[model samples]
Target: MSAPFVLLHPFAPFPLARRTRWLWLGVAALALLLIAAAGQWSARREASFQADSIHRAIEVHALALRGAAAKYSYLPFTVAQHPDVLAALAHPFDPAVLQRANHYIEEVNRRAGSDALYLIAPQGTTLVASNWNTPRSYVGQSYANRPYFSDALAGRNGQFYGVGQTTGEPGLFLSAPVRQGAEVVGVVTVKVSLQPIQEAWGFVRDPILLTDAHGIVFLGSVLPWLYQSRRAVAGSDLDWVLSHQQYGAHHSFALLPWKMDPAPDLPGFRVQTTIDGKPRQFLAVDEALPELGWTLTVMADYASVTRARERTWMLGLLCAGLLLLGGLYWQLRERRFAEQRDARRELEVRVRERTAELDEAHAFRKAMEDSLVVGMRARDLDGHIIYVNPALCAMTGYRADELLGRLPPYPYWHPDDVEQHWHNNDATMSGQAALSGFESRVRHRDGHDVLTMVYTARLIDAQGQHSGWMSTVVDITEQKRSALRQRQHEEQLQHAQRLASLGEMASTLAHELNQPLAALSNFASAAKAFAEQGRQELLVSSLDETAAQAQRAAEIVRRIRGFVRQRTAGQEDCVVGALVANVLALLQGEMRQQQARAVVRVPADLPKVRGDRVLLEQVLLNLVLNSLQAMQATPLERRVVEIDATVADGRLHIQVADHGPGIPAALAEQVFAPFFTTKPDGLGLGLNICRTIVESHRGRFTFADRVGGGTVFTLELEVSG
Candidate 1:
């Protein structure tokens, strides 16, 4: 049978009457016992509240720490992904590239507030440092023994808390792998100062300790033994805090007075609370911060509770004494008891009010939990799924009960993204990080990597215990797909525009080829006539003409090929005169076909320009061909196409003019616009891409009405003389 629970009110009236005096004494005694119990309960409750507050404060500190880590993570990733950095690292120790990379690293470190950032070779040699003041120190050091650098070299991003090889001070090291696709090339390591953490999260004035999985103290404020002190007791402090306390794994208000000596082979610590230097009863709760792999032990003075109990006992004793002393005094005692009864009723009312407040807080928290965008889950270090929130269930399309024990490390990661997923997870799980947010692929319920923006926090159970992790994941699948589609469409548009330009130049090109062929035919006919006449000298002359004609035919073919070839495909060297002469020759046939003759204005001598001769010919052909078409229906006395060439402003400038109707002012500019041609059957891409090609070659193309009654197309090309 359980002992009967007793309730006592400080203001309850004491029952006293002739026959009820004994019963009243018994009632007063019961009240005294109940008051003692209540005092003890209140003390325990206050202690628990303090413990909970401490746990909450630790969480805030961890949040600050994680925020810093997430910031640090982006630095190395940015450096590794930068085009200049990639080009630099692609080569074998190019001094110029390395110097540029060093400068880049310095700039990044300055922005990120990092103490040290450097690149490590696969063999663990420091290739370059953002700050090279200690060159000889870390430049040749072996990072093979360091887990972060080694793991990164093995194609994984890794992090760890360890002593700096160069500074010989404790620090958090984060490393990201530089990969050429699947192969890891180098490691970029960033070292962060823990001092910022101390500033952000109030600590050191209180007992704060940070430990790792190996039980080694990574950080401790105001408690040297918690870190740096090479003592077993310092390392075992966490173990002791866990074993000796009945604190819940959450925030609690409790005071525990206990001690343990974790010194190697030494008597364990002995600790407990004292009141005025005397041993006093105490209560405590354990706060675990699993993310940091540590716990907090909170203690307070329990003597005040004892004193309160003693006071209540003293009051009861005096009341009994007074009641026994008088008949007249009994009336006064009765009045005092009546007052006590009223006070008790008021206390009950206050308790109800406090309970209501607690309920309100719970309701607000529930609302917030339901509205959060990201999924939340808790896991143990061994990768066991312990708990999950409803948001997480919704994200994965799984019921809450199904996700309870399911490990979801990379369920939604694209096959290509799995490796990166593991690397990031490893970094977070290790105390090397606090909180991290990134754009990564998560597996959706529909089996696609729901491109998501995830903000993950290292889970600390209670005090500073290193729980696995909890993340808020927002699906960005639509946005990602949209961006991808936009990029592909842009590429396709560019390709189509290129092809359209080529199609527009076809007519100009036919004229170019026909000119040389016509010359060859004329030369062949002359040779044949000479052969029939048996004129030896004339026959020799005709043979020379035939040879020249053959050369002309070859030149036209080469020019046409160059014009149509992809810009990056080939190279050709020719003088400015030769290129211009070739364009006129090709267009001669088209000019003839259109009954238009070209007036060439090229000088005898011109500086040679290096380029694809064929492409240059194509540019001139297009201009001259347009001049021919412009004059086709004109009633001018002479349908003339004027071709002019000169070197001006360090560039080759050529113009083609026709004696046809002058270009309309409004349509002159619009002619160059793509797909805006005035011709009935035109694709309107010729001049547009002609300008595009010219600009690509670092030149310009423009048009204006000719001086007389036609249009003029101007071409300027940067000369490599």
Candidate 2:
């Protein structure tokens, strides 16, 4: 057996136990002190980190707010320099001048995204406003008591924020004085909405507040805090706010129930407030917007710092407890080490097997890529070709070695399309490639062009990080050729249809030219008779009539020729009135024969539209002729076709309305279908062709029932600038 089992003690058991207990107590006390120190350190660290984060966020927010305001800063000054504004201020009672100024203000306000743009007279009367057309317009209103008006009248740039008296909307008002020589004539004020900035702040979890010089909150992420003062308002400040109507008449100007104190170990202040009937703490950071005389404050949750401190204390206690258990675990460490060695050996074997399987998978993927018919290529973010499969090499007739490591303007790009290829490459690199893929022409090694459709997607590495772009290219040469052939065939058919339409209009054309020619003959005969009788005055008058009739006949012939002439399609600025006149002239004989009257109501001031003149004429002619034909059954006195044109929202609208029976709703969908017709002898291509022409000109063709009893066909086209 081993040596005799004997126990030895350094001291008596009870005294030793007491000594050990005291030692543990002392150690525990020391541990408690250390834990407290660590908790304090953690609290400070967390507070500092939060303070820095809040400081950065507040800077961003302040910059954003400044940027929003700055973008509209020059607007007021720019408007002040406008001639219309000056004219309106000088002639405030002149409706024409005021109308022009109001329109200009409206356009500028819309384009600049300002809430209200208005001009104020020297006496503080609103002369013109962007909302002049609205019932709640600021025009004719007086703002003489407003400080911004006063400052501008004093010949200084003025800036103020307040609730609009007319709209009750809060906005920042920027004003500039309109001066003629040394005299201050008027003020140009621009009101910019701060709601967007407040909305952006609301996206964050922190409470953000924007306060004016009087410590009143003008804008805040928390809606209830807006217009609330940080301190009590009294004396002159309260009087000024009330007199100026700064926060509107109804605001009570109550103080926010919040208090601030210097944080113990942080760079910012500790703020305590009652929100929703519960107390909350925050670390508050302030940034001043000196230019606007405002302060931006961001408040972050302080409870997180407290939680971090408590967690630090708990973690320290856990470490001390772990140390106490360390001695108890020492005996089993060697056995655990032996067992871990065996486990590690088994894990190594499994890892080796997994490595082999991964290698096989990679090889299989490579083989699959190489066997694909569609070309595959991969590029890094910098646009250097990193990989190309064998199919890509065959498609471009270039070897992989020649394609790899290549930048844009690659050898496979068509020589004439290098710039286009570079543009596509840039778009792909910028992650703007279209999902439907793009078509490109690539050059083969043999100098032949190959049409290709390329689709690009972002390539991700194993860690799910974007590495580059992967492109799949398909050879669409044959497909494109087929489509081209089909388009050519369709164009031929359309040309034939146009010639057929002209053929059908031949009778109407002859009728239109007959009356003018007949009048010319009559005048010529009269002139001859007058000359033969030696009557000089009668001869001159007859000759003048003859010349006028001849000119009319020639015009009819010219219009007919222009209508039927075949030329390449082109676009130009065409006047709407002129288009309507020509269409009616072409169909004059038809209207007269059918006993139908034409009522044209085109605005003289309508802007020109950009389109092919002949094509537009054809569209109008077809519609008018159809109208004339449709109203054949109506009573002679009531049969009328109305052509109306107007300009709205930068677009030209032309409507052709008739007083005949309206088209049935069931047939509306089929009206524009090719080869679909309501007439027995009609080819059913007029409406279809008209729609095609309108759409090709980037205009819309639509029809709806008129208020009374007929169909109204509308053509909406963009106005030429």
TM-score of each: 0.36, 0.56
Q: Per-candidate RMSD vs. true structure?
A: 23.4, 10.2
lDDT of 2 at 336: 83
Give the best candidate by lDDT: 2
lDDT of 1 by residue, 563-582 (tens): 55544333655676676676
Give one digit per residue, the lDDT tens place, for model 2 in 341-429. Answer: 86898989999999999999999999999999999999999999999999889889999999889987799999899889989998999
Mark the regions of model 2 whose C-alpha exceeds 4 Å error after superposition. 1-149, 158-368, 379-386, 405-409, 417-440, 457-469, 476-501, 520-582, 599-620, 642-670, 690-721
* Reference-based lDDT, each prediction: 0.64, 0.88
TM-score of 1: 0.36
